[model samples]
Target: MEIILVPAFADNYLYVLRDPASGKVAAVDPGDAAPLMAELERRGWGLDLILLTHHHNDHTGGVAALVERYAPLVVGAGHDSHRLPPLGRAVADGDRVAFGGTSAEVIATPGHTLGHIAYWFAQDEALFCADTLFALGCGRLFEGTPGQMWESLLRLRALPDATRVCCAHEYTLSNARFAVTVDPDNAALRARAEEIAARRARHEPTVPTLLGVEKATNPFLRADDPGVAAAVGLVGSSPDRVFAELRARKDRF
Candidate 1:
């Protein structure tokens, strides 16, 4: 599979995945059709599938346009089907949807939004976790509780270390800034922060971050760790409580 990254709407990222064998193409969280169309035209590829993570406009705004053009099969969470654009197929957690000659496992992640779902294409090692998980920070509790988000993160954290976390935004630098405040003494985090700063200075994307790197440096993913618990002033508290405090502080950060 070949994956292409297209930037849109200031910080949002749109992904185009293609299967080398069959030349089938799929778009994930297109957000905007202009850039995605341009890229497809550039490559002379046709869209065959559209995978939506949530109902957020920034993620699904281009669905109508893209569908009108390509008539791609639209897939999204059945749990939030009403809010999303008309879905050709409404999937649930653990459901597998085929695309580009392969399939993606739908992961129900309901913190950023009650019906948010990520697509993990195991064969391609890509996890399209739109807003539920970021490089150093997780999504805000827009429509769900901290516990829900924490559980969502835990499920994501259990994936293989080499899995590429293809989250949909360019919020890594800002997230890194807040992460250091909570995991101050973490050498790996500090080093990664410095690296992120350098990458941003060069206007490079820091996304598609490795799950292994995130486990080592991302504080939100480390809410249960002793150092992270103490940093949030929630030592001895349950992981969910510690996670809640960390999230609250981050919201203010």
Candidate 2:
């Protein structure tokens, strides 16, 4: 499987996945179809599937246009179908969806939204996690509790270290700034922040971050770590409480 990054409305990212063996194509969160269409035309590919992570407008805004153009099979969380564009296949946590040569496991990740979910292609080690997890940050809690978001992050953190975290935003620079404020003494984080700065300076995408790097440097994924907990003044507290504090501080940052 090959992944292509397409920039959408102000900082949002839309991913296009291709299965080499079958020449099958799938798009994740097409916020704007014009760019995606242009890319597809450039590559001479036809869309076959559309995987939606949530019901947010920025993510689903292009779905209607793409569907009208390619008539692709649209998949989304069953619980969120009422709000999302019509889903050809409504799935829930743990459900398997077959692509060209491999399949993906739908992992329920409800933090950014109550019905948000991520698609994990084990064979490709790719995780299309829109808004749930970012490069050096996590999504804002719009419709879920701290505990819920914490548990959701835990599940993502448990994936293989080499997993490519295909998150849907270009917020790494700002996230790195906030991360250093909490994990000030982390050498790995400082180094990663510098790299992110450099990448953004050159106007390059700094996402599709490795899960291992995120575990080591992303403060949101390290709320349970003693250093992160201590930095937030919640050393002895549960990870959820620490997460809540970290999230609150980030919101205000």
Estimate the TM-score of every prediction. Answer: 0.99, 0.99
184-208: candidate 1 lDDT, tens digit per residue: 9999999999999999999999988
- Candidate 2 collision pairs: none
TM-score of model 2 vs. true structure: 0.99
Q: Give the lDDT of residue 149 in candidate 2.
A: 97
Q: Write the per-residue lDDT of candidate 2 for residues 1-253, one digit (tens) a residue.
A: 9999999888999999999999899999998899999999999999999999999999999999999989999999998889999999999999999999999999999888999999999999999999999999999999999999999999999999999999999999999999999999999999999999999999999989999999999999999999999998887999999999999999999
Residue pairs in candidate 1 whose N, alpha carbon or C atoms collide under 3 angstroms: none
Candidate 2, 43: how far from true, in Å?
1.0
Please state the error at residue 83 of candidate 2 in Å.
0.1
Candidate 1 — worst ten consecutive residues by lDDT sum?
98-107
The CA lDDT of each predicted structure is 0.93, 0.95
Best by lDDT: 2
Q: Global CA lDDT of candidate 1, please?
A: 0.93
